[model samples]
Target chain A: MRNSSLIPFRSGGGILMALIVAAMAFLACFALAGALGASKLAGAWTDGLSGAATVRIGAEEGAPEQQLDIVLDILKSTEGVIDAVPLTEDEVAALLEPWFGAAPELSDLPAPAIVAVTIDSANEPDTSIVQARLDGAATGAVYDDHGEWRGRAASAAHAVRSVALGALIVCALAIAAVVILSVRSGLSAQSANIATLRLAGAEDRYVAGLYQTRYFWLGLIGGIVGCILALGAMVSFDALSTVSRALPSLDLSGYWWFLLLGVVVFAVLVCVLAARITVLGTLRRGA
Target chain B: MILFENVGFRYGRGPDVLQGLSFDVPDGAFTFITGASGAGKSSLLRLLYLDDLPSAGKISLFGRDISTLTRDEIAWFRRRIGVVFQDFRLLDHLTAAENVALPLRVAGAREVEYRDNVAEMLQWVGLGGQMHIRPPQLSGGEKQRVAIARAVVASPDIILADEPTGSVDPEMAERIMQLFMEMNRLGKTVVFATHDADLVKRSKKPTIDLKSGTSSGGVAA
Candidate 1:
């Protein structure tokens, strides 16, 4: 009745509890967004390798060096082959060292050239024709189209994305629950105030509106703060550059309105949840 | 006007505090309800203020059946009735002026519009110098006076007070009673529950007597 405090929005323990829920809602959303970013980063790797393919050719070393030259000639004359580069002996050795020990126990190691082929989409070659011509014993050339591997990798990435998105939804529901619980507790604490309000001719809506607006602002302020902290963390990690793996970057440049809308809607929803619980609980008190 | 017909209440497994009670408070009349401790006097006041619903029978406020009204509708009807509790129940965070203006504020009247009225009401309750003081800082009598100011500030259709003068001295009690009288004289129906027989005799209002959980006198008038 007589509040001397300037920031006079105290509704006892209830409002404080509501604020706590609001903060939790914001943090939950923050965690959800982080998971989303992580999943997106994982998915970006497939996009990076979209336009590349590798061909591995295995041949006997005892066979004359003429076979290697023949394969190279055919690759050059091929319509879809924009360029073909064969790996040197040392380059092949370096690539195999990670998989096997570098020293060879036996001599005459039959090492075949690995060719990277780039196709000109304007004159795409028929893979079947290329494979049929190059699969002979002299060449032993194998076209290892990366599309199937890329597809599997993309599927894994999408799986991660789905799991992360699901986690985000659970977090949002957790936030909603916290909002409801906090509001109910807050209403309980202010039972006297509510009774006073009711007797003073303030309807349920008026009482609920007070809590709704208060929690809405709380969620908005907390959500924006969480988003800013998330962005700062992103920039900080990128600055470190220790993880060259591209972390999922938020496309925030043109999406400010979306973020604003998210903050507003998030705040409103949390507030509405809190207000609904409080109003219903108070009304049930038989006041 | 307010009326209760065959009203009864039992707070879930507890014995009935009010039972088979019937009373009508006429429009714009000042009345006193007197009883001993736990005599259901406060319970009766609770019914009029819409704080407790009748467990049975009917309660009429402004000629509408309160028993059938929704909580929202009851709240709306209650806005026209002001209540002062024994505990004063002033929101501890609000200033005296704000507390007094609470009724007007709840009614959605602009502060600019209600400023003069609230100021006059505070002055009438003899709390002019303490408008800025919080409830906790005020003395018992001062708090009681502030509560009285809040009750009548909105010029409500009815004012229900439960032992409003219970904590004040005789002199202060008389002052608070006079304020209620003035409000009633100005056309607001007034019902005050009190143990202070002296205050009741001094005001000379028609009295409703309750004893041992039952009305000792005739139906409320």
Candidate 2:
């Protein structure tokens, strides 16, 4: 009966089914984004003092060349600190390319001096103690403590992730609503069919089972289609960002499989629930 | 096997469709319910089938009180009875044999056990060669026979038919009525609703007449 009832969901050129799936995909992607972002931020926060950290050395603008020796000397002796090198103009230009495009606007600006710091894997040096040593002599030099900002950055990233997941949940709810409403409307149109079955001694479960079966299939087809579309969109995005690995990106992590599962489940559940209500209501009205 | 005592039913706040309608149908009896248009014959059949509960009286079928029965129980009760509507409510998609086999299937009979019986019933109704034809393809008389076949195939305890012969020719009407009579003789209570005076007089079944909301009549003219 469930299969027989679902024949109508496929009867049309599949309009209702397409919309339902698209909604599922939309929710899945949004929820997946949150998962991706949170995972990345967590990875970044935990390994804050690894191969990636900012190194700062205070120096007067006119005397950077003279102050370079002392800063380099301090960096060499610092415990658990790897090689510290001042950033060249080309490295900064490459970092700025994504924001300003490949043709960087270089005419009116002098490159701000940046230090590249690598800390040892086994331990990270305390930057504050080093900061005390170079304070008075190197006036403009400050130790690069990127970890100071990691907490705030991780907090902000986590916030974005929460919102993305919440949006996904709302999307799931909306998909459920859409499927439910369409199922109910379809049931109304098919009331005569339902009444005939009831008159033929079909039980409430038997009659309602028809609607449930129809909705479950509708949700599934729709979900699979929507997921495929989202996967396509993500693939295209991945292709466009080939050279830039540091910029914010979305990748399907281990947890995203759960989200995909959830999308399909949500679709089926809404359809079943909606169909049950519709069938029971019509039968109750003695139609 | 069916009885209605002081049964009064209304659509809503409207006047009664069937008011104080007291009637009894004995087991295996064939009876005709005759009245002019809008005289509540259909309403009376509706009550007999438990399609709708009467607003104010006790109705019984198979000796069980129906007025206080739950919806599920009423549904089960309906399975013990069969009906043929005037419009010939055969599913347009189902074949003639399939339509006839419906009630038995509804009663949860196994396919292997019912297939041969359904085929015999369809043949008995004079649709021997058109078992595979759908309702749309069948002629009016053929469709009515299909409906008749459907009503009796389950061998229900009672059969209620509303205007069973309204769409068929006189000869066909007589044949269909004979089918109902045969079922009655086999111990199934039967009620036929019609306004055809010729059918009423020809059949000679006890007539339950309704006129201006009363049973015992003053106008036999």
Candidate 3:
């Protein structure tokens, strides 16, 4: 606290550094949000589809009604099948209502018969065996356990998360670089002051502490401002469009305090570390 | 308290500034190093302060060989020796009291413990009323007094001054020399480097005259 008077209370470069930290923190928060959102979406999709599958019966081979009955019977007898229900024609039409516009012409279309199958967690049935049995019992029958689509969704989410992580890393590096440059400039400006301190028998830590404490507070203030701004922007954007609504709701209200605390702590640490290294390096070289 | 054996020094790749310099100053002695400008008087004092190491000779202080001391140990040694520069070198932003309290602060002393001592030192040097003023607001003589107060406030064992009276008038110069003499009388070794032959002759203290780099003659009393 005594050395606080040795350094100027206000530096233009310090202000600039704080603003840069704020911007970086803002971008970092958004990147983290993107990563979290992607992870949540992937989890939701996996949870919705993990225990269910669908079967399609073609009308080209035998009578569609007969093929449906045969496929339903086979699914019911399977050990892992919890329930297998064949879809009525009216239900199939309702499923296609969104695309067909509820027109009477939808009834004339050669839509295949569909059966919904739920599997028990204790006994997972092999879909390949199920499809083979269906083919033998009723030609042109197909089984779909949704594995391919789930894998693709997982891979897409992973790629998005990776990009978000890459963005966060880039923001961190930029923040550190800004802090280093700011501290270096301040040191160069105060070289004479530093010499006076050194001649007074002050150690390297003493001099470096002056700058680190200043930058640490600046970083904390900037980080808080940035986090608030980012959250505000998210809320505004979510209100303006339906895209964010379609994704899983973040509900940051329950955990925002912790997130803000994390951002402030991280920012302060980066600033202090950058300033310490810069000051120590300069002093060592001068020595 | 100080010894040098055939000390030699030079800037990087430059010719020798001081060579084959050998001398010793007894404890509690008042010594003056007199020379023309650039005759290496400041450079010699710098060696004693460990600011610059001897290039080709050995130097010892307080009975410990300086060449063997680590950087931290050298800093500790420096804390015991006070240095006064010609430029005053007071931080322009700090008040006189703050400037005088710098050494104690650097040593990590609590402010409440040293506040009264700093104020008493300032008053002793005749700057009691100007303690709250910054360096830029003080006169040149007053600044020099503040610098002297700062140098001696920590009660360092040795005080090294480089041209302490170079910028002040004759009356003020004598007053400043009286301060250093008073400190010397109190058992602190004082080594002053100056080009003022008149002041040197008036004091009649032991003087080391340097002409090029080597000592001109043995210590002249």
The sequence of per-residue lDDT tens digits that candidate 1 reaches over residues B1-221 is 88878788767779988777777888888888898899889888888887667787788899988777887788778778888888888888788898888777777777788888988888888889998888999999999888888888877799999998888877887777778887888889988899888877876778888776765564453
- Best-first order by DockQ: 3, 1, 2
Superposed on all Cα atoms, the candidates' RMSDs to the truth, in angstroms, are 6.0, 7.2, 3.3
- Candidate 3's residue-wise lDDT over A15-102, tens digit each? 7788888998898888888887788788899889988899987756658888888898999998799999988889988998898778
What is candidate 2's CAPRI-style docking category based on DockQ?
incorrect
- Using TM-score as the measure, name the better of candidate 2 and candidate 3: 3
Q: Please give the lDDT score at residue A246 for candidate 2.
A: 53
In model 2 chain B, the worst 10-residue window by lDDT is B212-221
**C-alpha lDDT of residue B210 in model 3:** 87
Fraction of native contacts, model 3: 0.52
| DockQ of each candidate, alpha-carbon based | 0.39, 0.23, 0.48
Question: Model 3 segments beyond 4 Å from truth?
Answer: A1-4, A61-81, A101-110, A120-139, A242-252, B62-71, B198-205, B216-221
Better of 2 and 3 by DockQ: 3
Give candidate 3's error at residue A57 in angstroms: 3.4
Give the number of the best model, judged by TM-score.
Answer: 3
